[model samples]
Target: MTFENPAREEIKKILERADNVAVVGLSDNPERTSYMVAQAMQARGYRIIPVNPNADEILGEKSYPTLKDIPESIDIVNVFRRSEHTPPIAQEAVEAGAKVLWLQLGIANEEAAQIAESGGLTVIMDRCIKVEDAITGPLKK
Candidate 1:
């Protein structure tokens, strides 16, 4: 059976509980979607850890080459990578002990979803975390 993502109730809870978000495939370029999303989330209070091979920093946070390289606890693994590149990141997110594996818009990898699910991670696929946060923000008011 194809992996199904979590419902809105669970998604809201994940956002409410998560304090740190590790952005995989994050880009330093201001024009990039990853950068924009990460920047917005960072501005909204969630700590953004830049996980990119080339950059040493993004949005004032130190960058790491891989998920396994992050020394601190990760509340979420937010991926901007292609579907094909996501399965390994999913595995590494589990190894790194992240609570959630979140895929950006238009990205969906069944294998990665399965891996994350088996690793006990709450997986959100083909959806923008920033968008979800925006949708749920009004409820807090």
Candidate 2:
């Protein structure tokens, strides 16, 4: 089956109600795209939870080795890892009970999308969360 993202309005509503964002593959370095995107999202008032095993902390938030390690509820599981690596993350997100699974730009995995969708999570692939937020406007608090 072909993959299609949720409609713009649906995406807007998702962003609007979302409060906690768990960013997988978030980099410790400020130079990485993952860092930049998470930073932008944080600036918009979303709590950014960094999921990086190698880092102790990122963007002032304690880093977790995996989604299951996060103690709080996650609204969105924003992934910066490669397409081939996303299926497992999707599974993790499903187990974590996250509301949405978002794959970053240039990354699309049909298997990952299927896993997320089947697990009852909203799936968005090959899209930049930062760009989508910009177009969708400031998130509701």
Candidate 3:
């Protein structure tokens, strides 16, 4: 059977409670979708950690070459890489102690989801994190 993401209520809970989001495969270019999405999340008060090897910084945040390179606790790991490249990212996110693994729109990898799920990290595949937060609105607390 194909994998179905968590229920909407569950996703909303995750969005409401999380803070820092490490954007894997994030791009420094303003024209890229990753940059735009990450910016939107940053505007909404979610700390956006740029995870790109090529850039020293993006959106004024220090960019790490890999998820494992991030020193702090990662609440969410939003991925922008291709489907074929997601499994390793999932592993790194698990190793980095991330609470969630979010694969950006158009990226869905069952193996990666399995890895994350087995590692105790919540998995959101083929969904936009920024859009989810917009839909869920601000937390009531």
TM-score winner: 2
Give the alpha carbon lDDT tens digit for every residue of 37-113 in model 2.
99989998999999999999999999999999999999999999999999999999999999999999999999999
Query: lDDT by residue for model 3 over 57-116, one digit each (tens)?
Result: 999999999988998999999999999999999999989999999998899999999999
Q: Write the per-residue lDDT of candidate 1 for residues 1-141, one digit (tens) a residue.
A: 777878898898889888889999999999999999999998888999999989998999999999999999999999999999999999999999999999999999999999999999989999999999988764221
Name model 1 segments beyond 4 Å from true. 138-141
lDDT of 2 at 110: 97
Q: Can you tell me which runs of candidate 3 are displaced by over 4 Å?
A: 139-141
Judged by lDDT, which candidate is best? 2
TM-scores, each model vs. reference: 0.96, 0.97, 0.96
Relative to the unseen true structure, what is the C-alpha lDDT of residue 25 in candidate 3, on a scale of 0 to 100? 91
Per-model CA lDDT versus the true structure? 0.93, 0.95, 0.92
Instruction: Quantify how close model 3 is to the true structure by its C-alpha RMSD in Å.
Output: 1.6
* Steric overlap count per candidate: 0, 0, 0
